[model samples]
Target: MAYYKTNKDGDGCCSHSDGKEHSNEHIYEVHGHDKNEHYGESCGGSGTCRCEDTHKEDGVRHNGANASSKCGCGTGHGRSACGCGCEENFGSLKQTAFQFGTAAVFFILGILFAFIFYDIKLFNFLNLKLSSVFFLASWTAAGYKVLFTSFKNILRGKIFDENFLMSIATIGAFCLGEWSEGAAVMLFYNLGELVQNSAVEKSRKSIIGLMDLRPEFARIYNPEDLNGEKLINPESVKIGTLICIKPGEKIPLDGIITEGSADLDTSSMTGESLPRAVKPGDEVLAGFVNLTGVIIVKTERDVQNTAAAKMLRLIENAQNRKAKVERFITAFAKVYTPIVTAAAVLISVIPPILNSLIFSAPLNGFESFSPWISRGLVFLVISCPCAFVISVPLGYFGGIGGAAKKGILIKGADYVDALSKAGAVVLDKTGTLTNGVLSVQKIIPSKGASDTGMITAEQKEVLTYVLVAEAHSGHPIANAIRKYASENLSGTEYEEFKKADIQNYSEIAGKGISGLYKGKPLFAGTESFVSDNLNGGISRSENSLSGTRVYAAFDGKYLGCIVLSDTVKTDSEDAVKELQALGVKRIEMLTGDNEVSAKEIAEKLKIRYSANLLPHEKVERFETISSEIKAENKNNTVIFAGDGINDAPVLARADAGIAMGGVGSDAAIEAADVVLMNDNPVLIAEAVKLSRFTRKIVWENIGLAFFIKIGFLGLGAFGIADMWGAVFADVGVALLAVFNSLRAAKCRKA
Candidate 1:
């Protein structure tokens, strides 16, 4: 048995840090105590060993197994400790159902008494009828919270909310002797609210199910006794600690494999279904599942800093930032309520006075005022803005959740709105459209040198000197050259370069690396870097090559050039085509790579290209393109996608920035508005499609709510409709709009 510390911030599986009360209980394990002495009947073998002992060092004390405990901070730990928040959600739903059931019974009984026992005189108080008593009971039960909230809000100077509108309308009905209609209105409104809550909870649970990637426990590797490996909380695991990952278990943290090999399933983190094979020394991230073989890993990051944790935090915080449409609705509700309230007052007072004055009829009877007053009450009920206030935000929330399920993280609803209107798309060439992995494609020796097959004696000698220089550098080209040498050189030749002495190693950014190999000056980089050190430059013939060329020089003589290329991603062409189909008018590529390689990729993808641009120049180019696109259509937006730190500036400058999260640098992810977790270019098009669909659903809900409320308001004011019709307009229409908003959560696959 082991003991683990409690999560003080309540961000663990059991407790939610959002300040909502949860019924799930978390048990704090007690160390250095006898289990039998502290065990209680209420423990029920649920793995929670509540202790009677007080631990002063840990600042925890337990009175009994069934009793509550307090932490060092003096906050009591109750039922929020074991599971997710589902239990509390279900409990709330049950309570709403019980209240609705009780109110429904009373309302039905009152109706029965009024219709069947009309002449019978039951118990009465202060001239109140028997039916009136049952109706009052029903209203009190269903509308108590609403009435209390309305009173509190009015005292706080917040009088333009839905609760106030409902309270005034239903209380007015009861004042006019319409007890049954008043009870019915409150009962139906409660029902609608219950349905709305259930829908929202359903969407929340759906997102949780999709993103439940956190590992509960990590096995600490014990080399001396393999069978004695300890299971500990992932958050407690420190960096550089050895951890054992068994087959079928998730890698608990980002680390490099120190031993063994396996195939990993990265779909949870990247949304790609293909299994990637890895050997010792390969880097693995948290949330990736080990498919086969046990591997020992040295942790590089702690639990809270893992990629999975960052994504979860991003999704949770996304809702706090509202879109323009959502802000408009909120502002509309504030002004809309006051204006509608004024109209209701005018309808109640002005119409009857005009009729009495014009027709010369008496204005002193209850009958004359009843008709116009009833219309005003109905108008208030019809004008409640609950449908717009609740459903509009819910619609945007559903969109964000649905996009996350597909491995696309939209930072907020504002980005979703921008993505839906995307007209110009600019993409970085390397690591975005291409694989970003440089590999040796061709190696050619200097002219007049004899060669055999792909590698001659002179080529091997040239590569040996090149490797000695590159071994000191960590650039991607250096790695590619090393890999090629290792696979092609003989065992003795490889050992020769490995043991070669090199000094005065230096690197120039964006050009090449230089070192003194065996006391001879050696250079391996771009044509200018190698030629600048020589009296005469190398031939420009290599510049016509399709891939990037790196020229090497040794002892003031040209040793030849190595052609390295980064292959374009398999999906890049299809992604561009899909963007066109989605109505994106301007599609282009911007790259710091040379003109030859950039043009080759752009031609293959069938889009426009701008080559030989620096990082800042890319941003300037994007701004010019954005201006042209916006000038044509003011609503159009430009989106720039990239994965490197250099691309961070342009990613931030665009109207909406998309980052390749899987392989993207931290700076790019932070500056981006949307992150494609899969690192797949095709997901860019999928995001656009999903955004348009979500926007369509949101507008549909707005249209549905407005049409019904306006039609019913007009009907109620003219005396053609009654309180019953107003109930249908407010509660019925709200429920319909809510159900429609739920459809936005059903995202289609790319």
Candidate 2:
């Protein structure tokens, strides 16, 4: 196995291969190369690139001119290459348009026949019978699917849907001898169905358009011959494999640029409208299109595991999770349908019987009941519960998609509901609210020490000892110390001093490092690490700085301390105010930093603060805060945000766990319910705003649907409305609610 690097011209890129055959391997295979390049000795054919094979388990693709392969994936979506298995025969916009056109012609012809031919008799059929035939023809033309679906659902014992209700009400009109009314009701209902169906399809197209951001092919090249490029399926791309991305191609997977530069269009993933300029060593996510230049990227993840795929999975899975409002609607519809059917029957029978008996009139069997039965048909049509049942979940779906467009990935509908109710938001200090990079703010000299300049000779020696002890460490604090020492010290003296040998270097967890420099012990760490080791060389009284204090000592004598600080993020204060404005009752910062620094930051942000807590103690404090908030107001919920492995516990335990996905640990990301992909603290407030807006839209749909349906029910029962009017009230209201749900997609603030 070997690792090869690519030049700026996108040549000579390769990765490790074990020289064993796998079914689906990366595109880089060992082959004969030029004498100067070092890919391998010869083209042995022992290692094969999986792209040459045409038959994969899911589908087969052929490269030859006459080769044909059957593809049933994404057949009707007009995106056959993406391999999504969406059904093609589910009816298209063209089909809907044709249906509407034909129905309108038939409806107008039936109207002419009913009005003009009522007195003309043909053969044994009366004028009314001829007109009835014309209206029935129009009904069949417009409501064919509704009629067939009703019959099928009846056979399947699923008899409580809108299809069944519509079928029953219109057919009941014919039974009551209102032929024109029956045909008009079915025709108008189908027209509304067409409109609602088209809106829903348009919404699905918006989401599917986002899913199409994945690239179809990856351009791979051999290390020995960069000119020999191969097109391979993105699914076959492996981690750590080098792939070349040309301009106008979508990035196939999550990766880092190995060479070259590009301007990326990230609107599909982050809704950022601007093209971002990226250079080598910068990480790029999937679903962004490369707008300019050809860059070589080394894959960090497989196609299915990239950020784009994860966001899609989250959205698809959000539908399966029921929000509280959705569940309430489901339960309400289930019980309301059967109760209304019984009420329709009672409305037909009881009022007519009581009217004839109480008024002492002659009750004719057929004629006396006909009027009441017509009113019952109107009741049944108004009883259809499709409006509320469909729109509430659709609203949540739109909300989730809108959040992902902003780079906030919410895992489920329950989380959307939780975010709307968020009250107490607890934050981890290091990375959640602060920049998390340690840099020296100031240098402090011991009291009564005369200056050999502000940095005394003793101080320079102590810095040199600290630098030597921290030389091999890769921690941020250590890097800050090393960088300071390199920049401030005289260059010639610093280069010469770097040659001094040190031994027994070791880093103590949560403390610092120690080593032997020139046969004398050197130490640098927290106040406790330096004090206990140095034994009163510099008293603790002189080291009471507000920032992170690192003391240095050599051979049991303390020189001075360096004050390093992790600055609060630029967005932190505004984000806190936004959270408060979004109705978060309390905000708190939790940290392992000392009390003085914690208090200072909390005061500046004007939020509650807890200090000097260990990882487990942080969780305990969060629990106490949560209980107190709940005790005061039971509706309040606690949300925890963090970006470290130690934060996984609290993230999982909180009502809503938000992980900063950009720099978060794998454990924290996996445990979190919501992931802020850009690591912006302000997105928490934005997410809350989006959730609240979605819930508001959902409630509006619910109230509107209920108000319209109930008003129609009363009017139909009192005989003020007929079946035709009921049809309009039912389907028209449903179409309006569906259109209203689309507002969630347009919500820009969240």
- Let me know the TM-score candidate 2 reaches against the reference structure: 0.78
Off by over 4 Å in 1: 1-95, 111-131, 448-451, 472-474, 490-509, 514-523, 529-534, 554-558
**Which 10 consecutive residues of model 1 have the lowest summed lDDT?**
35-44
Query: Per-residue lDDT tens digits of candidate 2, residues 256-302?
Result: 99888999997776656779999998998887899999999999988
Model 1, C-alpha of 7: deviation from truth (Å):
8.9
Tell me the TM-score of each prediction against the true structure: 0.86, 0.78
State the local distance difference test value for candidate 2.
0.73
Model 2 ranges with Cα > 4 A deviation = 1-104, 116-131, 208-212, 221-224, 291-293, 442-538, 541-544, 549-562, 661-668, 748-750
What TM-score does candidate 1 reach? Answer: 0.86
Instruction: Write one digit per residue (lDDT tens) for candidate 1, span 240-334.
Output: 99999999998989889999999999877777789999899898888899999999999988876777766766666677788899999999999
Scored by lDDT, the top model is 1
Candidate 2: Cα lDDT at 433: 89
Enumerate clash totals for all models, in the order shown.
5, 0
